[model samples]
Target: MNITVCNPLLRTPLSLIVDDSCPVINLTYYWIHQRHAWKARHQPNIAPERWEGDTIQLKKIPPTIPADFAWEWAEWCWENGVKGKFSLIPYPAGIGRVDEGFPDFPTREYQAWLRIYRELIWPSFDLTPEMLTHTAVVDLDTFTLTEAWEQVEWVDPPVDNRLTDYIIIAMEMLDNVGIPCEGVTSPGAFGKRQEAAYARAVLTASQHVNNNPRPFYFLWLKHDELPDVPIWYPDKEKGVAIASIVSCAGDWFGGWTGYDLGDADRFITEDLQGGCLPPILEKELPCVLVGHWPGFYFNGEKSGFEILKTVKARLDAYDPDGTKTLWMKNSEIGHYWMARELTKLTVMEEPPQIHLSTQFPTANFTLALDTPVRHIQVNGWDLREVHSRRDFQTDTFLVEGKQTFVAFDLEVGKTELELIVA
Candidate 1:
């Protein structure tokens, strides 16, 4: 019998990536100010004409998104079982520290924002810091803002300890505010120049703060092809690995400025025939969609939020009954890819048996075998076979055509399987 590893339950993976998000402050408002300052000091020719348009857009958007909106969004995601990554900027363009409190912002309101994040957002999302501040670069030694923009200046330098230190500081700030992070989110073009060093820094910082050996980061946005979760800085002996998970689709719901109303049909048409998601689903690849927090607000109209809902509805229509697609967080997708690449499998012909050795414990690990299975026992425990894909889950097997698919909870170290076939 020929045996092969398949996707988690043999379903296409889907996830969302939200950037430029923090607790209360409308990041764009402060973000624009910092960019203007940086432009004057460093690059004086950064589109001087667009400054007025930026300021005009800022006036239309609220200074803060407020905790009420956060609660509403969190509730919607929870009800829908939506899972993804959300960024929390520790300093937020040097406006204020999340742990301490933003200057001039009401203390009570700030506390409310933190509480909403801890109770609601934390449950369904992988929370990460979009670096220390999303604006001007920070001088690690002086703890002061430099004239250079973080996205521009930071990506220029080669891999060094400073990058690791910078990431650690951001993670620590979130930790102080009672939010534990498993990864870091890059701000704009941060670390895009030297990906190897950035990957190393993320792994080192995550290990130091969260003690997470298998970490992931979000950096690039790709559209032409299905994005891959590429592993970086793997140390088998030390049990450390990191993955760069890229988003597959652009922000079609709205722009980061919270002013541009994005088209939902760009992701998935109402007919469910066209859009970027269908091709990804057809290929059974991870369709990680990208969006921004400010855009979701849409200047308080929530147009972007509505667009997301529309896209999700279209996806369901395309893969109704949840048989073809699986919604997952970026971290979960990373882990699945890691297991797919690193886990070693051994098969035996006599009496039919299989053995698996994995460095990470993964859920819903699925395998397809060419021969029909009479029974399967993982470490002496018999697995119950399910008839339908909807019924298929961990410790369950399904038979289709010449292939018999088995899904189970894969543990760390080693697992022994006794495959009794006819």
Candidate 2:
């Protein structure tokens, strides 16, 4: 039910609007009276109906608070051990031919959906373990019970087009935080070879300005008609299979390719196009953004649902102790019917600390505190780079300095922390 704007800082809303096919009720947490975005936990913003040919409609609508609606639904969510601010709104839908009248409803009904949501439904639902954002893969090209989600003609599915959407969402989030960001979702290039140039321009423009080390979350969606990639299956026998390398993963593995149903080639192309996921896979992102458009959701899991549920499920379960509803990834319920809950199932240890100090802002800071550091090396934030290294702990005639980075591990809430000077 959350619509994302792009930016680095994370936001948890007390209220949100849910779009099933056309549009419907707004959801809210029982007025906690904390955030400004939410007006008194019970009230929400809603959008008014628009004309058929309108290209742009009112973006912001006040969520309506219904009379029959009660806080009782929250209890259902809470008692079931559900937690988090995500609203899991199930709608009746599947992909179908374009010629068919969409949503199978009248124009007035669209407004009616909104009415039922605000007046009767919204204030009554529970929270799911979903987050503000998540991830999933859509096999839109494959056959599924859901209706086909073909790309918009204008949405040429170009690299620039994909990049544009990602940037738009990111910039919107930034703007929300009062940071001015500007960019465009340009039309993609004509050929595959032009991608490198397009990607470079978009990225360079994003930089060459900001000095505060602002965050840039880049999401590269591959648009190859036959790009090779990994095939993940929920089935036990059908483990992960290599299809083709994705371009975003970099040229290290080589360019990617497509796959035939029975094609059992283990290794094929040199370029393993990898890292298409926004912010690029494994690249750390402080926050992720996603859209809550109706077409994006009713699309269904396993068919092409990652746009809605994937982000929702992971982000919702962000806090472990928090009780969020169990939303299965992709609505792709695993043999189980009830939507899955995503409590903080496991705790991941934070990477070891690596404090960077220099003799001077201009001094040549050289010296490897090479020690057996404990970590796999992930979070490479643009502003800070942390790493683990062992230094000589004075015992015997150690061939090293007398200190290591581990001694300066930061503890939570330790205000005015101390650091070693080089």
User: Model-by-model lDDT, in order?
Assistant: 0.84, 0.23
TM-score of each: 0.96, 0.23
Off by over 4 Å in 2: 1-179, 182-192, 207-219, 222-294, 297-422
Report, for all candidates in order, the number of backbone clashes.
0, 57
* Residue-wise C-alpha lDDT for candidate 2, range 1-422, written one tens digit per residue: 11111111111111111211112222211111112222223245632222111112112222222211222323333344322112222211221121122254454534444444344433332112111111111223442322111111222334654433433333333333333332222211122244343344333434432221111112233433222222112122211111111222221110110000111011111122222322222232211112222222211111112222333333343433332122211111111111011101121223234333211111111122333322222123122223311221111111124422221211112112122223
Error of 2 at 406 (Å): 6.7
Worst 10 residues of 1 by lDDT: 47-56
Writing each residue's lDDT as its tens digit, candidate 1 over 175-266 gives: 89777797889988799998888988898899899889998999999887667889887665555789888998968877788887789888
Instruction: Estimate candidate 1's alpha-carbon lDDT, on a 0 to 1 scale.
Output: 0.84
Candidate 1: residue 397 Cα off by (Å): 0.7
